[model samples]
Target: MAFDAVVTDLDGTVVRADGTVSAATLQAAHALSAAGVPLLAATARTPTGVAALTTLAPHLAFAVCCSGAVGWVPGAPEPAWCELLPRAEVADLVAFLTRELPTVALAAYDSRRWRMTATYQAMRPNTHKGPITVVEAAALPEAEACTLVLGHPDRTPEQLVAALIEGGFDPTRLGLHRAGRRFVEVTAAPIDKASGVLRALRVVGADPARTIAFGDMPIDTTMFAVVGRSVAMAGAPPEVLAAATDHTASVEDDGFARALTALL
Candidate 1:
């Protein structure tokens, strides 16, 4: 396919294990952009996290943030588009989660800032680098939010997801997916990486059949489904690997850079 756009996940696809973008990956991104291919970072990260990526790759003008609830362009002040959960629903979910998983930590984010419950800060120290307001769970403001994160250091993501389902979180009303081994992200229903990719395509005027996507997690599945070429990283979970059209080397092996080199 004569791909004109590239979308990649951040943590395990393009960014290295130590939370740095490799030189090769950056070069590949530059090469793609120089060749007229738009590069987008599709991730579950909030705008704060997306900022770090945009700083690294200025050519990357677009990002799918908050799993898919927000589409951001750095320096734009506001997102290109945003989807927010209802205030009442946010309050109800907070109350429900607190009742069911009292020990779990919770963090909520809008487009700009994060409000982390005291328990979440205690559970995952130094997880977020940007300014975070520590608040009580019961005091969590009833307001529009882009994403809510449930963190449990001891439980697997699958277990956490099951727990949320058991807590009466209707899938039709929300998007629930594991972002990592211990984090399950909650967003507005029908929002995900694929939806974000679609938004990016609209902004960039790229055809779905002419877009290439790369990811290494289950959250990336929707993005894979939307693109013509889906490349999963080596050593990804079996389900993620199965969801992709092809497999590439692991991030540690510079798989992302290699794949881009071959494609661009």
Candidate 2:
């Protein structure tokens, strides 16, 4: 196979539910390094969240964080690049959401700290980093941020996205992705895993057509469409599986290692 580069999703792919990387995966990572293939990560997680994967840090050359809105080198203090939400556009979106989803709570990640509505605090409770600032809903739109968080107490993330679309919310100007725990992440328009992966590829001098990706979520589908080869975990949903060029065992079964081993 001889892939030039490998980009993988963290959770549900290489990282397990309990946040551990299997020994086989580590061995495969070392194998990739030995073969001179740079390993990259594209995740919907914030840099802080990605930092939790301490064991996998040494394997990654770069991490595409915040669903492509931000890029970071594993232990870097700042992002390589970050795209923030347009203030006026955010205000307009907030106004629209207020009318369409009255119960929806809003939060902003300004690349520094999170400023969230009290309602968001109640709903997400203790999940955010410390010094979380509870602010009024109206103030959230004014906060400078690379990503926005939208959630509802009554509606699932999927339902919330559906409701927004049905209400004529234009997602084209912004990126919206369903994330863990009943929330949707919104980033600046045109920001996605593919864009971030391309950034890393450019720096690594890897041919995009020779890059292989591994993932198990819908978020990974975008990356799948751009990369040369895409390997979906066996237990992934049908759409994720459909988007991939190959299939591997589940994460618990060391699917990431199995795929990389085969490719090498």
Best by TM-score: 1
TM-score of 1: 0.95
Give the Cα-based TM-score of candidate 2 against the true structure.
0.91
Write one digit per residue (lDDT tens) for candidate 1, span 88-119.
87888888877877787888887767888888
What would the TM-scores of all predictions be?
0.95, 0.91
Count of clashes in candidate 2: 0
Name the top lDDT candidate: 2
Q: Per model, how many backbone clashes are there?
A: 0, 0
